[model samples]
Target chain A: MSVLIFAELDEGALKKSSLEAIYYGSKVAALTGTSTTAIVLGEGNADELAKAGRFGATKVLHASDAQLNEGNAMAYASVVAEAANQEGADVIVLAKSSLADSMAARLAGKLKAGLAANVIELPDVSSGFRVKRSIFTGKAFAFTELTAEKKILAIKKNTITPEETEATATVEAFKPALNDTDFAVKVTNVEKATGDILLPEADLVVSAGRGLKGPENWGIVEDLAKALHAATACSKPVSDLDWRPHHEHVGQTGIKISPNLYIACGISGAIQHLAGVNSSKVIVVINKDPEAPFFKSADYGIVGDVFEVLPRLTKAVQEL
Target chain B: MKILVCVTSVPDTITKITLTDNNTKLNKAGVQFITGPYDDYALSRAVELKEQLGGTVTVLNVGESDADPVIRKCLAIGADDAIRVNAEPTDAYFVAEQIAAIAKENSYDLILMGRESIDYNGGQVHGIVGEMLGLPSISPVMKLAVEGTTAKITREIEGGHEELEAGLPLVLGCQEPIAEWKIPNMRGIMSARTKPLKVVEATGKDTLTHITNYELPPARGACKMIPASEAETLIKLLRTEAKVI
Candidate 1:
């Protein structure tokens, strides 16, 4: 038995989240006394996938089918399930992104395996493969154990620390059993945003809210994010008001992010917004109002005008 | 275009979470429940699709009788009917099994749900259901349109989005920016009282995962106040102590 990991890719390179999954799967494989094999879907550099050996993958399964490049959860799940069965894997691991979560769920059902999602910690194999995960909008956590013969886990991005090692793993191309019907959904066009950082995988996040005053004043937020090499996020209201795209919204009604450090500028720390970001390791809030609710949850607080605070913060960061 | 929208009842987003006396269960004191926010988008979108295409929209939930009120709320939002699988959501896998069973029985042309429920935030149900029914599933969909037997969906990708076209019998995990949510009206609320809400025993397999205990996250440290004029000091603190820069 081995651990099968889905190594996610984008624009022909392994995504940062996949590295976390690889590290996580490798740890699980070590605990279970099994090897870790990575499956690469979509178009990506084969050499980079083989380099996943640094994170503990013993081998890489490269499915280079053009049809597999565009994601369809059912198709991806079917292929992964078949690969798991063929390799006699006891555990299947994936990132907890929307795409991975859907595929992991379906793969679990197809394999009739035990599945866990949004897992933050590696399981203790001695105690029936128990893992810890956040629930209730990061409000609580539960330590769960999978009892089925086959277990599947979706690891949250940035939660697991990726350790690097030196080992050259072999890469082999494996063709999954798929047909035209499996491609029920076909991709007609691909539209990608031009940016250096993806929000979900970002380690540092700089977010703005209505405190910026208006969309024209968003330069401070953007400049701060650029100086910090962070992704830019906004409050739900900002996104609702069309100041930012919906994907950039981070809150209870938006994307929940747990970056290493989250700097909030102008956001008042609404409870809904807190539900999404309270998981960040360190939180810094910049607001003119000392009574802003976000201050209660912040690891650091700056009671000042964002217009003045952000430029200074950005300058300071650039100096660093 | 018969659309099936699945909604899950979960703890309110702001509810203070606590473990029960047994540690294996959640504490219920003062906890309020509501329909998962993601599901609201899915339900509203399904209602919109039904209105545009002139089709029946049904809402499904996998929960106990306590979830009936939320199910009725879905009906009030214009779902023609409802189904409540009379079982505690054991886990994502089990819940997906229940949904898949219902979907197979009904043969819905389109299946819709939130990307993930707030309580568990598994984000696996749509994918699992699609796999079980051998149908296409697109998640984190930002835009969707129906034309004849095909669905034009704009899927949210990293940094950008991808547009795809799929036939009927597809699953979509609706996210934000899909559409504006609609509130239930008096007429719909009254009509919901008479809508059919069928409760069926769960046919899910034994739950493979078991929660050993619930734990709250470590308390955050006290906030350190940095003077607005002393921005340089704050930046130095971040670079040296915080080491985030």
Candidate 2:
């Protein structure tokens, strides 16, 4: 049973979450005594995708199709299904990003395979494949058993650390038969954050809530985040108030993240908010109110004004 | 025009999550159940589209009879009718098949569901249903507007968002800001009791996946407080002690 990793590219660079998927898929392949393969699609840099060999992918298949530059779910699913058949892959892995998840859904239907999304761990494939996944917005976990010959798995972000090995992969090009109808929905325009790190892949995150006062005072949070090289986030209320983009909202109704270090400022931590970031390795809370519920869950608490403390913290990190 | 919105009853966001029965199932004791928050956007949009296009909005659920109250709430919120498939949804594939079969029978103009459920986090049903019915499916759509038989959708891609257009007989997995949630009024609540609710047996078979058990996440450790004046000390701890910075 060969393992296949679907590495989705973000503006020519591989998504950081894809690296984690490759690392995890390769380990699963090794556990099952099979070679690992990665399928690269769209207008991504082939050399970068081939770097998956360092993460345990022994083979990389790149489909350099201009028509697939703006990927469509149905078309990509068909292409991935063909590649999986060609590679003799019984298990397919993908990063649980929104687009890959969309494609994964179509791929499951096309392959008539069972799919388990938001998987956090590899399966015990010695018998039937059994894996663990987060449910209820990371408040609890569910162990799922997939009793199927062919299965598709989407790995949640930050679940696995990439281990780079000394290896080079043989990059090969493969093409699948596709038609204009495959591009059912034509993309008209795109808006992006350009160079900013994606929230899901950030190792360090600097988040704020209403405690920051208003959008005008966000400069301090941005300054501290810049000093620490972390992605920015906000509470649900902040997003609801339009203080930040909806994508940056972190809570039960927003993006669930598990960064290595999460620094929350001025945010009164609600259970819905905690549901998103509780999985972080270390949490630091800075708020004026010491009784804030977030402080109870924090690894370190500092009772102070974010306005005064943020500048000092930024300067201190720079001095170090 | 006919529209169907899929609603899921999930544990409320504030529910204290726990495990029961040897950690094989969720402990429902004292838990409050509500319609999935994301799905509220889809349901509200369905009701809005129904009002504008002079059509009927129907709510669909794959759950036991206990879910009837939730369906009625959705009806009160503005749906014209409801359909409850009498079965416990095991996985996305099982639920999608039931939806696809129902849609095939009804031939609705549009089918909408939340991008994902808060409980399972499986955002697979919309795409599976679309593929099964051979229709166009767009997910994570933030903005949707209909004109005649075409629908303009704003969907999120990796690191960016895109605007796309597709024809009717489509599936949309909705997210935030697509449509504001609408609350049920006293008049609507009273009318919901008289609205028609059709209960049908599930027609799909469970495939490929089953939950073996469930477990609560480990509890957090006690927090350690630090002085507000010690910025340099905290930075030092983050570096040498935490080794994270």
Candidate 3:
């Protein structure tokens, strides 16, 4: 038996999260006594794809097709299902990133496989496939069992610590059938600023809320983010007031991020917002109110004005 | 144009979550329920689109009859009608099947819903329904503009947003700044009671995944208060103690 891991590429390169996923799949493959194979659909060369070996994959199937240039969930699922069939993979692993969850869901349906999304741990494949996941907005955990012949697990990013090994993978060419129906959504334009650390994948995050006052006062937050090479995020109210982009909003109703360090400036921690960010390994809060709810959940708390504390913290980080 | 919007009712954000029946079920007693905050944006956007583009917005819920107030709120926010599938949504795939069945039966040009419910936070239904119905799906769509038979959609990618063009018969999972949250006026509230609220029996299907138990995350320790003047110390701690910087 083989374990198939979907290794999505960004601009002809493997992403940090994808590498973590490969590492996770490799660990689980070891437990199951099965070899791990990575399936790359989009850009990247075979030599680069074989680098997945360091993360536990023994074989990399490169589906080098022009039609697979852009992401289409239906077509991606079709290719993944075909790859699973060709490799005789009983367990499929995918990263629970944007568009990947949808692709995994569709593949689960297409293959009649039991799907477990947001999986945080590897299953006991020695017996039945069982996994753990966060539920109730991170307030609770749930143990799930997949009963189907095939199991698809979309592992959450940053949930697993990656380990590099000496194993290298062999690259192979893969081709899957495609149809016009897969091209329903057409890409009109793709716009992304070249080199900014995205919030979803950042190791450190600096966030501000209404306490920052206005959009004009975002300089200190940006400076701190720049000094630490971290991503910037905001509370829901800040995004609602158009002080920041909605994509930067991290709350229950917005983007949920799990970073190594999350610094909140001038934001009172609400349960909704905490539900999104409480998963961070370390949280630091800066607020004038000592009784701010965010402080209760923070590892470190500073009761001070954000305008003063933010600039000073930025300067200190710069000195470091 | 006919637009279909899917909504899920969830416990209010402040509700203390507890599980019962050996941790297999959520204890619903005395818990306050509200329309999902993210979904409100979708329903409001659907109403806004219907007003601007001339379409009938229909709300669909794969939930039990207890979700009437939430469905009525969708109507109050300007959905022309609502449909409730009388089934407890057990899993994401089951809910997706219910939505796909409803969408297939109706001739909706556009399907809309929140990116994910705050409760389960699955974020899988939109794409699953779209794939089941053989339509394109765009998720966490932050910007949408409909003109003629095409809609321009913008969604956040890894670093920034990607602008795309999709024809009718598409599913869109919406989030904030796409449309502002709409409050129901007095007239709308009164009319909401008169709006069509159809309840249908469940069309059950095979479920592949099951949750066996539930447990809460470990509580975090107390915060270490730092004086405002110790900014450099805090940075040093972050580097050495936290090892985050």
Quick one: ranking by DockQ, best first? 2, 1, 3
List the candidate 1 regions with Cα displacement exceeding 4 Å: none
**Ten residues in a row with the worst lDDT in model 3 chain A?**
A42-51
lDDT by residue for model 2 (B1-245), tens: 79999999888888988878998888888988899988999999988888887898999999988788889999999999999999998788889999998998998999999999989988889988988998878899888989999899998764557889888889999988888999999999999999999999989586779898988888778777878988557777878877889
How accurate locally is residue B158 in candidate 3, as Cα lDDT from 0 to 100?
63
Q: Worst 10-residue stretch by lDDT in candidate 1 chain B?
A: B204-213
Tell me which residue pairs clash in candidate 2.
Answer: none
TM-score of each: 0.96, 0.98, 0.96
Best candidate (score: lDDT): 2
- Candidate 3, residue A48: how far the Cα is off, in Å: 2.9
Better of 1 and 3 by DockQ: 1
Q: What is the per-residue lDDT of model 1 for residues B1-245, given as tens digits with 9 covering 90 to 100? A: 88999998888777878887878788877888888888999999999988898989999999889899899999999999998989998877788889889988888988999988888777877877777788878888888899998899988876667888998889889987777787999999999999999999999466877788888988888999999878678888877788766
Lowest summed lDDT window (length 10), candidate 2 chain A: A42-51
Q: Please rank every candidate by TM-score, starting with the best.
A: 2, 1, 3
Interface RMSD of each: 1.5, 1.4, 1.6
